[model samples]
Target: MKRWYVWLGAAVSLVFLYFALRGLQLQQVWAGVRTANYWWLVPGVAVYFLAVWARTWRWHYLLRPVQRVSLRNLFPILVIGYMGNNVYPARAGEVIRAYVLKRRERVDMSPSLATIVVERIFDGVVMLFFVFVALPFTPLPEWMRRTVVLSSALFFGLLLAFFILAASPRQARAVYVWAVGRFVPEAWRPRVTAVLDRFMDGLGCLRSGRDVAMVFVTSVAIWLTETVKYWFVMHGFGFSVPFYVLMLMAAVVNLATTLPSSPGYVGTFDGPGIAILAAFGVQAALAASYTLVLHAALWFPITALGVYYMWHERVSWSDFGAAERARRSEPEVVGTEMRDARQREVR
Candidate 1:
C-alpha cells in the first residue's frame, strides 16, 4: 500500500513536470546551457564530493557509541549507497548500505539504520534553518512562505520526537507495545514487540552529549557545503544570485526530496528547483536549464560512481533483493528481546 503511494506520487510529479516544461522555449534553455561556465562545474563537483565525505564522517560519529569505524572505510560505502538511491526507487540504496556495513564491517543494521535516521533529522533541521533565514531576502509568494513554515515545523517536530524517544527508551517501548497489542493478534504481539525493542536500541547513540554535539556540528557543516555546491552551480550558469538566496533554494530542493518520487527524484526535484529560482526572478528558461544542470551535478556523477562501485564490490542485484526479502521474513526478534527484558525487570 505504501509502495503504491510512492509510485503514484512519482507519476503525479512527472505529470506536473511535463506540463511545466511544455511551453518553454528549448532554444533559450539550450543557450543557457551553452553559455554556462564549465570551469565552475569542476569545482562544484569537487565540493559536492566533499559534502559526501563530511556526511560519511558524521555517520561515523553517530556510530561511535556502539562501535568505531573509520571514515576511510565508510566513504566508498556511502558513495555506493547514494548511487543505489539514484538507480533504484524507494531508496533501496539505504538498506543496501546498511547491509554492506553489516556484512563487511560487522556493524549491526539496527544501529546503522538509526544513524541514517539521525542523519535525516539533522539534514531536515539544517535545511529548514537555511530556508527560514533566506525567506526574507527572496521575493517568495505567500503560498510558498506558508509551505516553508509548515514544512519547517514538521521537521522540527520530528526532531523533538526523536529526542523524546531517546530520553526514555523503556517508556517508549511500553507505549509501543500497548499500541501494537491493540492492532496485532495476541500470538504475534510478542514477536512484534521484540523487533521494535531492537529498533529502539539504535536510538541509544543519541544519549551521549559529545556524540550529540558532534552530530549537530557535522550536520551544519554538511549543509553549508551543500549550499556552496548550489552557489557554484548558479555561478556556473552566469547567475549572480546572492549566497543566502542560493542556500535557501538548496534547502527547498533538499526538502522536496523527502516526498515520494521516482528514482533519482526526477520530476519532484526539478519542479522545486525551477520554481524557487523563478520566484527569485530568474527567467524561466534559465531556471529550467539551471535545474537540469544542478540535477546532473548532484545525481549523475554519484550514480555513475555507484554503478562502478557496485560492480567493483561484487554486489549483485540478487544480494540486494535477498536482503529485502530477509528483512520482510524475519520476525521482530530484536525489539521482542528488549521488551521481554523490560517486562522481567518490571515484574
Candidate 2:
C-alpha cells in the first residue's frame, strides 16, 4: 500500500472516531462494557463462523465454471483472506486469498481475482437489500440516505457491467481488442489480452441466469446468517432492537466499512454501528460498548485462525506484500505461462 493511502485511511478512521466518541459518557460506556453478560457471545461466535462457512460454499459455487474446488479446501483460504482483510490495509487479504488459491489450486490469479470481485459486488448488493428492507421500519438520517443512494448506484452499475461482460464475452472481447490495439504497445498487447481472457473466465458463472440466481440466493443466505450473529451480540449487551433494525445496523455498518479506514475498519465500522443503535433509542454509551465488543468478536477469532492457517499453509507475512505487489504488476510471463496452464487444466 502507498504510504499516503495508508495515512489517508488512518485519517478517515480518526475523523470517524471523533464522531463515535465525542460525548461525555466514558463512565457509562465502561459500565456497559463491564456489566454485559458474556455468555451470549458463545452462540454469537458460533453463528458467525457458520456465516464464514456459508461464505466458503458461496465461493465454491462461484468458482465452479473456473475450477470445482471443494468446500473443505476453500474454508481455510477464506478464513485467511478475512484475516488478511483485518490486518492489512486496502483489503489486501482479497489478493492474498487469490495468491493462496493459485499456490494450492493452480488457478490463475487474474481469474481468481475476478471471482473475488464478483463476490464483493454480490455482497454489496445484499447489503443494499438489507438496507432497503429495513428502511420502512427505520428512518435513516439524510446523510445515510444519500450514502445508500450512492451505494445502490455503484453496486447495480457494476453488476450490470459484469453481467454484460459475462453474458456477451465476444462483444466484450471485441471492445477489449479495440482498446488494446489503440492503447497498448505492440510488445504488451498479447500479454494484456491473455490476462483479460482469464479474467473473463472468472465471470463465467454470471453468464447463466440460473447461476446468477443461485449466487444471489446464496448471497442473501450469507448476510442473513451474519445478521443472526449481530442479533446474538445485541442480547449480550442487554439492548433491544427489532430483528429488522439489527439488519439495518448490519447493512449500514458494513456499507460504512467500504469507505477508506484503517485496517479492521476501526472507525468506519463503529461509528455507523453506534449511530444506528443510538438513533433507534439505545443509549450512546451502551451502543458504543456493544459496537466495540461486536467488532472484537468479529475480528479476533477469525484473524487468529487465519494466522494458524497461514502457518499451516507455510505462507509467511512477506507473502502478503507479494500478493499486493502481484496485483499491481503481474509479470508479463504470467500472461503466456498461466494462460497455457489454465487451458490444460480446463481441458
Candidate 2, superposed: residue stretches over 4 Å from native = 329-331, 338-347
Compare the candidates by TM-score and give the number of the best one. Answer: 2
Q: Which 10-residue window in model 2 sums to the lowest lDDT? A: 327-336
Q: What is the overall TM-score of model 2 with all chains considered together?
A: 0.96
Candidate 2 clash total? 0
Candidate 2 Cα RMSD after full superposition onto the native fold (Å): 2.6
What is the clash tally of candidate 1? 8
Residue 334 lDDT, candidate 2, scale 0-100:
68
The parts of candidate 1 lying over 4 Å away from their true place are 1-3, 332-347
Model 2 residue pairs with clashes:
none
TM-score of each: 0.90, 0.96
RMSD of each: 3.3, 2.6
Tens digits of per-residue lDDT for model 1 on 303-331? Answer: 88877877887877777775565455445
